[model samples]
Target: MFGDLMGMMGKLKETQEKVEATKKRLDTVLIDEQSTDGLLKVTITANRSIKSLKIDDALLEDKEQLEDYLILTLNKAIEKATEINETEIAAVAKDGMPNIPGMDLFK
Candidate 1:
């Protein structure tokens, strides 16, 4: 029984390393998304932090429109980032990944 438990712990360590490597890969895959009009756009990391934002020169003329576009585009970027994280984490977690406190299980 002790041997089996040790083996499981080793396997868990391997999985944890793999997940860390995967997360490092995600840092390289920045997500960029824009609204339909291209008046606003945002870049984000898989961890859901905004990297940057852009706005069209024309949209600058209307402050209210620019604000609205910023909000809309930001939401789109964040949603896309969430999807990206989920897809990646799910793919790796197919083999009974361990769950630790504060780990982004769903990613």
Candidate 2:
């Protein structure tokens, strides 16, 4: 029993390390999103950090329109990034989890 417990603890620690590494890797995974009209483009990392923004000159002429575009496009980009991040982390965690009786975490 004690040996099993020790192994489980080690596996958990390893899973934690993998999760952190995956998060760091996600920083390099870029997600790009553009407005429907292609007037505004955004590049963000899977970690949800903004990398760059490209705005057309026409968008620059109207403050309100620019704000609206930014809000809509950025939200979409963030949603994509969040999905990637969560899926990657969950896969890592689920793969590393020890199979304990009556514990079906991944399901």
Candidate 3:
């Protein structure tokens, strides 16, 4: 019984380490998305931090259209980042952790 408990603890520690490493990898991932017309672009990290934004000079003349395009472009970048984050996190969970009852519900 003691040996089994020790083994389980060891596995838990290793899994924690893997999770941390995976998160670091995720943080470094960058997702870039742009508007359909290519007038606006946004770059974001997998952790949902904005890295940079680019706007076409032509769009600057119209504040309303520029704002609308910016909002749309930003949302696309964030959505891509979220999709990648979810996939990476799910893979990490599946690979590093043991299956538990009711865990599928969360996934």
Q: Pick the candidate with the highest lDDT.
A: 2
Where model 1 places Cα greater than 4 Å from the true spot, the runs are 96-107
Report lDDT (Cα) of residue 103, candidate 3.
65
Can you rank all candidates by TM-score, best first? Answer: 2, 3, 1
Model 3 lDDT tens row, 81-100:
99998888777767766554
Candidate 3 residue 15 C-alpha distance from true site, Å: 1.6
lDDT score for candidate 1 against the true structure: 0.80
- Across 66-94, the per-residue lDDT of candidate 2 in tens digits comes to 99999999999999999999999999999
Q: What tens digits encode model 1's per-residue C-alpha lDDT throughout 2-106?
A: 877777688788877777788888887898889898778789999788888887799989999888888888888888888998788778764545544576655
Better of 1 and 3 by lDDT: 3
lDDT of each: 0.80, 0.98, 0.84
Q: Which is the better candidate, 1 or 3, if ranked by TM-score?
A: 3
Model 1 residue 53 CA deviation (Å) reads: 1.9
The alpha-carbon lDDT assigned to residue 29 of candidate 1 equals 82
Pairwise lDDT winner, candidates 1 and 2: 2
Residue 73 of model 2 has an lDDT of 100
Model 2 off-target regions past 4 Å? none
- Which residue pairs come into collision in candidate 1? none
TM-score of each: 0.79, 0.98, 0.84
